[model samples]
Target: MAKKNSNDNGKTFTTQQGLNSYIKGICDIMRRSNCAGALQYVPELSWLLFLKILDDTEQREAEEAEAVGDSFADSIPEPYRWRDWANPQGNRRLNLQMGQMGQFLPFVNEEVIPYLKSLKNKPQATPRQKIISEVISSVERVRIDTETNLLDILDKIHEIDYIDPTHIFPISQVYEGLLLKMGEKNNDGGQFFTPREVIRAMVKAITPQVGETIYDPCCGTGGFLAQSYEYIRDFLADDITPEQLKTIKLKTFYGREKENLIYPIALANLVLHGIDYPHLWHGNTLNREVIYGDLFQDAPPQFDIILTNPPFGGKEHRTVQAQFAYKTSATQVLFLQHVIDSLKPGGRCGIVLDEGVLFRTNENAFVQSKRKLLNDCNLWCIVSLPAGTFVAAGGGVKANILFFTKGKPTEKIWYYDLSDVKVTKRKPLMMNHFQEFLELLPNREDSERSWTVTREEIEAKNFDLKAVNLNTKVDEDKSTAKELLDFIEEKGKEVALTLSVLRKWER
Candidate 1:
């Protein structure tokens, strides 16, 4: 949203190139100062961008009101709105002169931020407005340690004035690019930022329709839902009626996330991608056996499509795990059960899971969960990714993208290995890497990197789906390193037992 003001240069820097250049420039400024890494940079940057968008949207709303002959009012009070305080040329600029550093720190840290925190946006404030206040209250100004850096960053933000229809899409990419940089810099952020390319691939594979309900239970940063909206929207744009579009915009994508920091980020991500008024909850998605009616009253019934990359290796509390049939602290195991129960009959899903879940003989829970997946759902495909895909975040364990549908037993499961392809942080995984896999997915065909095995065969292996890549020749000469290690450990135990007997005899 935007307003035509006196300084409206009418210069629409509406290209992704311009947005990228601006982001790069701002990031460089942050780095040159003490802002340092992306973790230190993005939180503050996100808030600043949010405030600017809010002020711009408010002005656009004001103009719309006047045009329709309705009286206009602002969500934010005067002297505190972005234009009043942040704009140097506006009626109420901050105490600091354009580039000066006088009382600017207190004005922001004491007055401005506090005012935002206290804002009610009130009695009849829209739910969207409530989200703004909630998100702002949770945000602590992170990298504004210096007056000059803060002022400079604010001024740079002021240059961008495109939150309206024509520019929002490409601009959304800028925000995603910033998050991508954060993920690359800090693997911890990876939990929030699944590679967009990977998400897009999953979305394409699932093929969510416009009227269908799509959900992500462990939705970190709302990546899956956002991309699903984009995919469904594009696929239906030509033939969609207004009512169908209304359904798409108002109630299509839904999500739930655990971390407060990431929850708001997920909401913001969805909104920036044009899914305004997102139905994403900021809480643990696994609180109850069934989520909607109990944990979230506003939530809908079993969704038609589910896509997610649940956090790998997270251990839920036993109390939380107690609700599952095959109870386990493992987050992936719990989420797998959650997804299975959450999907409607005929509902299809694409999810990411760690390698251990595929073959964990030590844990009966893991085996049971895999059995449930195959027995209760049609787990049609598994695309095994390279080990280094998530290695930066210490996720050295290989992973797979599982595509399945509810309401049928899995007769056959197809596996595609991308293990040979190196996917390090410096050289990250991309959509192109999945091209061959995608082409083969529809047919569920067998190839050099892909093959299928029956459920009976998998059952024979104790539900261990980590079958060797059929394409690779088996090594028959020497035992594998792990097997050799196991042998050594067993031999060492025997030697220790022998030593104890000899010592007892000597005594």
Candidate 2:
């Protein structure tokens, strides 16, 4: 029997009762002959969870609309109504398994497509239908319904408050766990599991507002985009009038990606957070596609606020057809250029970057190009996170967050140092450094935690964007005394106990 717990508000936990089982299921399904790492597998789960939640929401909304004599069901449009997509005409996957169909058709012409097209309002349906059909079937087979028998298993998920945009991580933790497990299976999979606290701190510093266009070129597990929306929701929820609320609700929101599996999850994450379906689009930000159109051939939309932690530390090199405004490798440099190109004249951006991009002199011209870009962009802030901050997932690599605004030469930039420290945590991956860091951010001149450096200072080092220049506090004396005394006390106690045991044995 499934374990059940009731909330104070009368909501009951059913589906996510056993957290371990859910984790095991995610691992088992992801390792199922994918010919890929956990990154690929967890995305499969992300997409599946998206569809089931949408179906469950549609079913509930339809019933509610009928009872209230409201046409919300007609107006709202069902983005993932299962029967509409899976049970459509001549589109049956009789003997075929999910992998075959997903590889073939993707998101187009599924049951959900028809329901969306039939919506009384919203033109996003027809274009949405044209997207590949595989995304739908891939999501369909992984459905957490009667077949998987994980319904009661996911009930505990409701307790998580994913719907409350303020509670971003609970929802994010659901995916983070899957990504971490995926990372364990494959060396490259760890990139997706950005700690929620780290993500929250990044979003806080970026200060995303209502109605801003947001983008993540490498949107692993959709953490940044989802958290950005929640940040905006919370921002607007404070000290705003009813009319302001309406405007904020209808404001344009967006996300772009090349990952086919992550695309659906990104959309679902946004929709669940209250953004309309039309806001999210799927396409390679780097490559031209029939659906997303050619970003290279045509000018991409200018985003007002960009928040992302781009994919990092991989050996694969990507080719570029044309010379870029910036110079660097495919993953980091390409994304940096993409984010720069995607921003409006006055946009702001925050991104997670590996230290290699900061101090590499091999690409001198590339380094010069980045300096020019940073100066032209008015780079604002850099926060260096500690090493053990992400130690559990391997890749003890150091990382930092870069914040900048578009279209102005930067005179000076503020840097905060929190690296090389241990955050108080009962478990691994729960870092509280962000909270401590944010407390000192408002001043921007805390001698112990932050420092402001001029462009000349940065240029002196040949434009390395690292954060080590910031002021820091270290306690070496305290560490020495604690280590020595703790060792002596432990050894002394052991010797005394051994002597007592020997005396007893002799008697």
Candidate 3:
């Protein structure tokens, strides 16, 4: 638990360490319960954290309304409210804890969850109520195995003060850390997450402004959209108006997510990041299928800027492929086509593409897609990411970041290579690694690591946009045959000695 210190005003504040410890304690209890994996625990935790924060926000709003002698309405009603049932100090929670042994669990499963899920179906549900409904839409019951564990988790979560200033950092950042666990190796969450450093670099290059709409067609847990919000908020901190702030918070960010599990997570994530309204569509982006689109109803047909890392190495059905201009089973390629068509004429995009999408010319779909990209957009820059860059996400494919603006054909392309820098799971990619790349990006400056390619050259090579470094020379091995044989013999002796020891141990 975080050690709480009382401020001069008598309000308690906790340090970042305290907040981290609290989250860790909650995860420990979750592991002991039913949600042992990131996939299981993250979704379960997202809803709980969301409700806790929402209740805090509403409580503050209600107090302000009372001070002004105005009416206040809560989106959640009665025992369904976190204060009513989840808060440790609340009378309802005290009664439940003091009642029949397992009563608390049944109330949550039968009454609370059902009432929350039914909010969207109400005759005149508010937008906030609808958002709440969609957030917990897939949650049939509490995932925590026992009442004791659930109650303990709630108590720890309650300690997190969302409205207080003492924490220094946004509580949303703590949630981002939890999302990172989902992207860790063997978690099966890489499909929904892009590395934060990569997202930061992309969002920086795109530099989305306050008035322009930003989008991600396949926004996993809403990382791109959330980071864009942070970037814009910080960038406009000095001169931004209240109306512009409102625009940025309520009307700027938009996205589409397909997974039943991930869609709600994306909503909760953006809300935590302070986006008052995240216009995210719940559906398959490629096929234009709508699972639920109430939040995205107000989104523009074309956005001013887009930043996304679409899923890699995914195969789509032909029926889905039939929707795109250049038909391909590869999900990335189809997404490229969709992004190109989805942008306004002068709109810009920053996208992460695997080497296959960049260099695979044999397939007509790949070649045609690249051709369309060059013809419709200014293919300005490509950053070749190092191998094992996505090893944490269980992906081993080499990848690159492509930045382009719609409405103009390609004249020349600037390429920056970070592939030479070795990336490993222990030493992951970071923002500082792109120092030289960003410095040179403004002018497309040439260096050993950076170079430019002309349109004519790309056409001659059938539009292979792979970042091939021309300045670096390959060092050829020139060991003598005798030396190689002696080295092999020494290794052979060591292997034989190890095997002999193993045989003796077996006996």
By TM-score, the best candidate is 3
Q: Give the RMSD in angstroms, all C-alphas superposed, for model 2.
A: 12.1
> How many residue pairs clash in each candidate at the backbone level?
1, 27, 0
Clashing pairs in 1: 1-163
Which of candidates 2 and 3 is the stronger one according to TM-score?
Answer: 3
- For each candidate in turn, the TM-score is 0.84, 0.68, 0.89
Q: Roughly what TM-score does model 1 have, to 2 decimal places?
A: 0.84
Q: Which ranges in model 1 have alpha carbons more than 4 Å from their true place? A: 1-11, 32-34, 69-74, 94-101, 119-123, 238-242, 288-297, 392-394, 473-507
In candidate 3, how many Å is residue 491 off? 22
List the candidate numbers ranked by lDDT, top first.
3, 1, 2
Candidate 2 regions with alpha-carbon error over 4 angstroms: 1-11, 14-48, 63-176, 238-251, 272-278, 289-300, 314-323, 392-394, 423-431, 469-474, 477-507
How much does candidate 2 score in TM-score?
Answer: 0.68
Error of 2 at 215 (Å): 1.7
lDDT of 2 by residue, 1-507 (tens): 111112333232235544446445554544543414555555555544555444445555566676767654323232333333332211233222244534313343344444443442334533333222323423433332232223222333322322223333344455566556555555444355466677788888878776566666666556777677667766766687766555443444555565655565555555445444424445655544435431212224687888776665542223542445543443565677777777899998888776666766556544865776676698888888764454445334567788889988898888888765543223343446566667776777656777888889888888887777434554555557786786456445434533442343221
Rank candidates by TM-score, best first.
Answer: 3, 1, 2
Which prediction has more favorable TM-score, 1 or 2?
A: 1
Q: Is candidate 2 or candidate 3 better by lDDT?
A: 3
State how far residue 119 of model 3 sits from its true place (Å).
Answer: 0.9
Error of 1 at 35 (Å): 2.4
